[model samples]
Target: MQPSHRYTRLTAIALGIAGVISFGSAGATGFQIRENSVKNQGRAFAGSATGQDDASVVSNNPAAMVNLDTTTIRTDVTLIDLTAKFKGGGRSGAGTPLTGGNGGDPGDATPVPAMSIVVPLHGAFEKLTLGAQLSAPFGLKTEYDSTWVGRYNAIESEVKTIDLTLSAAVKITDRFSVGAGFVYERAEATLTNAVDFGSGICANPQTRPLCLTPNPTAAAFGPQKNDGLAKVKGDDTGIGWILGFQWKPTDALSIGYSHRSEIDHDLAGNITFTKPGNVAAVFAAGGVTTYNNGPGGAALTTPSTDTVSVTYAFNDQFRMMFDAQQTDWHSLQSVDIKRANGNLITSEKFEWDDTMMYALGAEYDFSDSFTLRGGVAKDESPTNDTHRTPRLPDNDRMLYSVGLTWNANEHLSVDAAYTRITIDSPDVDVVSSSSSTLVGKFKGHADLFGIAAQYKF
Candidate 1:
C-alpha cells in the first residue's frame, strides 16, 4: 500500500471511532428522563411545578417547599421498558451491497430512582424551608446485534446522568413564596460501532488501485470482506441553577413557575480499536500500530427548561391540574469530537429544535384514605428526518397515566402509577461523511411503572 493510502485509511478509522460516542435514546422525547417523581408521574407531571404534597418539590419546584409545613422525605423508583424495532437496508461507501439481516430489537429495560428531603424551620427561621434531592434527569440505552445490517452505524449506545440539588424557599407573604437551588450534575456515556475497514480502504481514490491488484489476498480487503470494532467511553461533571415562584390568590387555586439553567460538560475519555488479523497486518505494514488506542474528548450541553403549572380544586372531592413546559434544545447543534492534543477528529450534526410539552390531570377523592389520579400528555420531538440517527430513534409521542395515592397513615403515604407512551414511526436516511448510509423506519413505544413513599414528621 502507498503512504497516502495508509493516511487516508487511518483518518477514516479515526472518524468512525470518534463519532460513535452519543448520548442515546429512550426517555422524554429527546434523551431527557422524566421519571424523577412517582407522584408526579402518576399525574403525568401535570402540576409538578405547583403541587406541594411531597418532598419531590425540592427538585420539581423549590417554591412549593414552603407548603411542606413539617420535615418530609420521599423515595421513588420507576421501571422503564422500551421496544425499538428497525426495518431497513444500507450500503457501503463504495456503493457495494452491505450484507446482513435487519437489526433485532435494540430496546432496553432500565430503572430510575429518586429521593428528596424537605425541612421547615421555626423560631427565627419560621418562614424558611430547606431541601435536597437526588435524581436522574437524562438517560438512554440501546443495543443492537453486532452482525446487523446497520452495525456500521451503531452497536451499543448508552448515556446516564445523576443530579444532586440543594434548595431553599421562603414565604414572602401569606399567599406568596419564592425559592432557588444549585444543581451538581454528572454525565457518562459509552458507545460502540463496527468499523468498515474494507470500505475505508477501497473508497479512497489513493487506495482503490491497490484493491484491484491481481492477487486474491489484495482483493479480499474490499467492502464487507474485512471489518473491525471501535468503542469509546467518557464522563464529565457540570453545575446549574434552578429558580421558582408560587402564588395563591384564592384558597382553592395555586399557580407556579420554574426555570432551570443549562449545564455544560467537557467529556474526556479514550477510544479503543480492535482489528482482525488481515486488517492488523495491513496497518502494521504501514507502521500505524499506535492507532489502536488514544485519548479523545467531546463537548455536550444539557438544555435549559421553563415550566408553568396551575392547580385548582373545584369541590372537596375533585381537583384539576395543568402544565406547559419548554426546553431549549437548539443549543445542541452538533457533536464535535477532538483528540487530546486539540485536533478535530469528526463531527455529528444534530440540529435539534426547541420543543414543548403539555399535560392535563384530574384527581378524585374516592375516600379520605385514597385519591385516584389520571393524566394525558403531548410531547414533541426535537429531531428532524434529515438529521435523525440510529443511535437515537425518536419522534413526537402521546403519554397516558393512571395511579392512586394511598394514605396508609397520618405520616406516611404511598403512590403507585403506570404510564404508557406511543411514538410515531420515524424514518432515517443518514449518510456519513465517509459515504456509508443507513436508511430505515423505526417503530417504538415505552411502558413505565412507578412507586413512591413519602413520610412527614
Candidate 2:
C-alpha cells in the first residue's frame, strides 16, 4: 500500500517541479545546445578545437586564439525552428474520461546569440594571446496548451542560461600553443503542471474518504473542476573552467584537444500552489495537503566535456576536418528538493548515460575572398524512452549543413549557414513519477539558420 499509494498525486507534482529547475534535455542533445558560435555552425562544428580560421574558436579552444591575425571581434545569431508533438493513447485511471485534448506541437521558433573577441600581444609578450566571450551553452523551451491532456504531467516549461568567459594563451613554439579560461554561468527555469487533489484519498487509506481540496463531505469522488495548478521557479549562478591545446604536426595538419570543467549550482526559489475553492475546503477538513510551504531549493551539476579534432589539408585549395566530443551526462543521477526549513520535498532519478558526437566537414577556397563549407554529424541523446518526459522527449539525431564565408574587404566579412536536423522518434511515456500518466511518441525534426559578421583591426 505504501509503494502504490506513494505514487499518488504528490509524486506527479514533485516530478514536474524537478524537471523544471534541472532541465537536462534541450532541443539539441540532452538539454545541451551547440549553436554557440555561428562560424562553427557553418562547419557543423567539425574543427571546433583544431580550426583557427577566426576568433570564434575561443569558445571551444582558448589556445587557438594565437591563430588569429590581429585584434578580431565576432558576433552571431542562430534562429531555431524546432518542435515536439505527442500522438497516441493517453488516459486517466480507467474510469476518468481522459479529459483535455492531445498536446499539439509544443515547440517554438527561438533565437540564440553569441559574441567573442581575441587580441594578440606584441613586444614583451610577442607570442601571447588574450580572449573573451559571452554566449549560451545550454537551454530549453516547451509550452503546451494549459489544459492539454498531459497537463497533470507537464504544461509549460522554459529554461535559459548564459556564460561569460575570460582567458589567455601562450604560443610555446610556431607549431604548438596552449590556453585556458575561466567561466561564470547562470541558469533559470519555470515549470507548471496540474495537481490532482482527488489523490488525497490515498493520504490515509484507513479512513477511505475521498479527499478533493476543501471538504470530503461534498462527494465520494473528486471533480474534474477540482484540479488545481502548481508552478515552480528557480535560478542560480556558478563557475567553471576550460583548458585546450593546438598542435600543428605538419604545415597542413593540425590537431586540437580541449576539456571543460563541470559547474555546480544550488537554485533557490518557491513553488506556488492554487487549488479550487471547494477542493481547498476538503483538504483542510481532512488535515491533508498536496504540498507544504511553497519555498524550495534544488542542487544540480552541469556536465563536463572533452573534445578532440583534426584538420588536414589535402591541397592548397581544399581541407578536411573531423571532430569527436564526449559529455559526462552521467553526472546527473538525481534531483532533490528541500523546503525552506530543510524538510525533504522529493527526490527524483534521471538515470542518464554519457553521450558523444562525431562530425566530418570540408572547406573549399573558391578565391582569395570567398570560401564554402559543408558537413554532417551524428549526435546522441542521454535520455531513453522510459525516462523521456513531456518537458522534452529527446533522442539521437543527425545534422546536415552548408555554409559560406565572404570577405567583403580586409576589415569586414560575413558568414552564413543552414542546417537540417533529424531526430529519432522517442517515446514520451513517463508513468512512475508524474501526477498523471502520459504516453506517446514524438516524430520531430528541426531547421537552423545562422549568420554572423566579423571585423579585424
Candidate 3:
C-alpha cells in the first residue's frame, strides 16, 4: 500500500482508539473538586477562608486550619451520576445529501468517584498546624456505540486525575493566621473509536476515484471496508503550591482568603490499530496492504491553573462564600507527535482559550446539630466550533445545588448534596481530508447528580 493509505488507516485507528479511551468510556464533565467545609458549599465555593471541618480546606485555604482548635482529621467521599444525550445530524457523504442521526448507544451513564483526607499535627508546635490531603479535581469521559451515526467521528474516551497536598498553618497573633502548602498531581487518559473511510468516501463516484488505487485485494474481498479501532494511553505528573490567610476581627465574625497554584502534567501514551479480516482481504488482493507497528505516540499535556476565594461569617447562625477560578486551556492549542526514530509525523491544532468560573453559596444554621446549604455556579467550555470533536461535545453550563449537614456529635458529621447542571448544544462543522463535502449542525445535552460525607477528629 502507498504511504498515504497506511497513514490514513493508521490515523483512523489511532483516532478510534483515542476516542474510546478518552471520551467513550469517560464522563462528559471532567472530575470535580469542591471545598471541604459543609459551610463552604452554601456560598457556592466561597470558603477559601472560612473552611474548618474537612481536608478540602487544604485546597480551599490552608489558613483556615488554625480555626480547628484541635488536631482534627477529616475525610469526604462523593459519587456523581452523569447522563449525556446526542442529537442533530447523522452520517452523510461529502457533497450529495445529509442525514440526521444520533451517535452513541442508548441508556449510557457515567459515574464520578472522589475521596479526600485532611490531618492536623501538633505536640511540639504550639502555634502551628500541619495538614495533608488527597483528591481528584479534574477529568472526564464520553463514548458512543459503533453503529452510531457519528461513529466515524468519535467513539469513547476515559480520563482520570488525582492530587495530593501537604500544608501548614500558623497563628501570627490572637486573631490572625496564615498557611501554605505543596501540591503534587497525576493524570491518566485512554481513548478509542472506529474509522470508516471505505463506505464513507469510496462509495461516492466523485470521491471514490480520487482515494482509490489499483488493488488486487479490492477485487478479492469484493471491495474494501474502511472500519477499524484505535486506542491511546497516557500518564504524567507535576508540582505546584498554595497560600492563604484568615482573620477573626471579633468573637462573632471571621474572614478568610486563599489561592492554589496550578501544576502542569505531561501525558505519554501509545496508539494501536487492528484491522478486520474482510478489510485486510481487500488490501491483500489489491497488493496495497501495509502496516507499521502503529503510529508513533505523542506527548499530551494540559496546563495547571489557579483558584481564589473568600468567606465571611456572622455569628454562628449565618455564613456566605464566593469563589472564582481560572484555567489555562490555551495550552491545548495542539497535540504534537514525535516518533522514537526522531521523526515529526504531524500536529493536531486545537485553538482553545483560557476560561473563568464563578460561584456563590450560603448556609443557615437551624440548630447546634443541623445546617442547610444552597448555591449556584457557572462553568465555561474549553472547545470552539473549529476544534470541537465528538469526544467532548461540551458548552458553557450552569449549576444549582442544595444540601444538609447533620452533626452526629462533637466530632462526627454527615453532609449530603445534590446538583443539577444544564448545557446547550454548541454549533459545529465536521470535515475530513478523504471526503468531498463538509458536515455541519451538531447538538446535545447532559445532566449530573452528586453526594458526599465527612468526619472530623
Candidate 4:
C-alpha cells in the first residue's frame, strides 16, 4: 500500500484503542482526595488517631474505627470551581504558528464528589470494624479554543477517575490498632487537536515538492486532509491494597500512620480521525483515500502507586496531620500502537518521571459543638517546560484552606470548608522549530463548598 494509506490506517487503529481504554476506565482524572471529613479540613486532615469523624477515619486510618462508641454513618459532598489564567507570550515567524493568541485568559472549571460509611461489630467482635468509601483521587479537565494559537500541540483534553474501597479495622491492644483494605479503581481520558503544516514550508508544493514526504507527519495526517482532529478514548479496571497502624501511648497523645499500594491498569480504546472534504478529496473523492480509512489499534499501561500519611493528636482539643505521595509517571513513557495485521507503527513517548507532593494541617476545638481548622500544602508540576501542552499547563502550586464544624444536636452535625489554590505560569516551547518559544504566563484560583450529615444509633 502507499505510505499515505498505511499512515492513515495505522493512526485510525491507534485512536480506536486509546478511546476504548479511556471510556472503559470510567473517565477518571486521578486529581487526588481534597476532603476526607468536615473536621479534617481544620487540622489539614489529622484523623488517623482521633477518628471521631466517621468517613475520613476509615479512608485515612481504618484502625481508628475500633474506638467508636456507637455505630455511626456519614456522607459528604463537595463542589469545586477552578479558574486558570495565562499571560505573557508572543508568536514569532510565519509558519502556521503553533503558539500565541489570548495567551493569557481563564481556562476552565472542575467539579468533584465523594462518600464513605463505617460500622462497628460490637457484640460479636468488639475490636473489629468494617467500612467502605467512594472517592476521586485524581482528575482534571481543560479545553482551549482551536483559535487559541496553541492548537498545534493541544486543543481539548479531559480525564476523570473513581475509586471504591472496602476496609477492616482491628484493635491489637488497648494502645495499638491495625487495619487493611482493598480498592477498585476506574479511569478515562480524551484528547483532540489539529496540527499545522505551514504554508511556506510543508504546504509550499514548490520550493520543496517532497515537503509532504510520507513520514511521521504524513503517516499521522494521511491524504484525508492537512488539518484534522484525532479523537481517542480509553478505560480499564485495577486492584490495589492499603495498610495502616495507630498508637495511643497516653490518654492525651495519639500517633497514626498509613500506606496505600498502587494499582496497575491496561487501557484499550478507539480513535477516529475526521477530515474536511477538501482534505479527504485529495486522496480519492467520493471514495476511500489513502487517508479516509480507519487504523484501529493502540494501548496504554499505567503503573502502580503509593501514599503515606501521619497524624498526631495532643489531647481531645487539638491535632495535626501530614501527608506525602509518589506517582510512577515513568510508566507513561510511550503509547504503543499495534496494527491488526501484526505490525508496529509509530510510538509517542512522553518520557515522564515520578512526582511527589506534601501537605500539613491542624485543628482546634472552640466548644463542645464547634471546631476550627486550617491547612497548607505544596504540589509539584508533572510536566517539564519542553513538553508542556495547553491541555494541562500546570505548574507547582500552593494551597491554603480553613473549615468549621457545628454540632446541631445529639444526632446531627454540620460542616463547611473553603480552600484556595495558586499556580504560576511557566515558559513554554511549542513544537515548531523556528518559532520555538511563546511569551506568556498562567494563573489559577478555586473555591470549594461542602456539606455532610452524620448520625449515631
* Best candidate (score: lDDT): 1
Score residue 292 of candidate 1 by CA lDDT: 60
Candidate 3 residue-wise lDDT, 205-270, digit = tens: 434453555873453221224556656676778788888888878765567766666566545556
State candidate 1's TM-score: 0.94
Per-residue lDDT of candidate 2, residues 230-301 (tens digit): 787888999999999999999999999999999998877877877677656655775664454466777878
> Local error of candidate 2 at 139, Å?
0.9
Badly placed stretches (over 4 Å) of model 2 are: 1-13, 21-27, 93-97, 199-223, 289-293, 432-435
- In model 2, the worst 10-residue window by lDDT is 1-10
User: To one decimal, what is the Cα RMSD in angstroms of model 3 from the true structure?
Assistant: 4.6
Compare candidates 3 and 4 on TM-score and give the better one.
3
Error of 4 at 85 (Å): 2.2
Tell how far residue 415 is off in model 1, in angstroms.
1.0
- For residues 4-59, could you state the per-residue lDDT of candidate 4 as single tens digits? 22233335434333322221110111234456465555444434344656556666
lDDT of 3 at 386: 75
Using lDDT as the yardstick, the better of models 1 and 2 is 1
lDDT of 3 at 77: 46
Positional deviation of 42 in candidate 2, in angstroms? 1.4
Per-residue lDDT, model 2, residue 106, is 76
Off by over 4 Å in 1: 1-25, 213-218
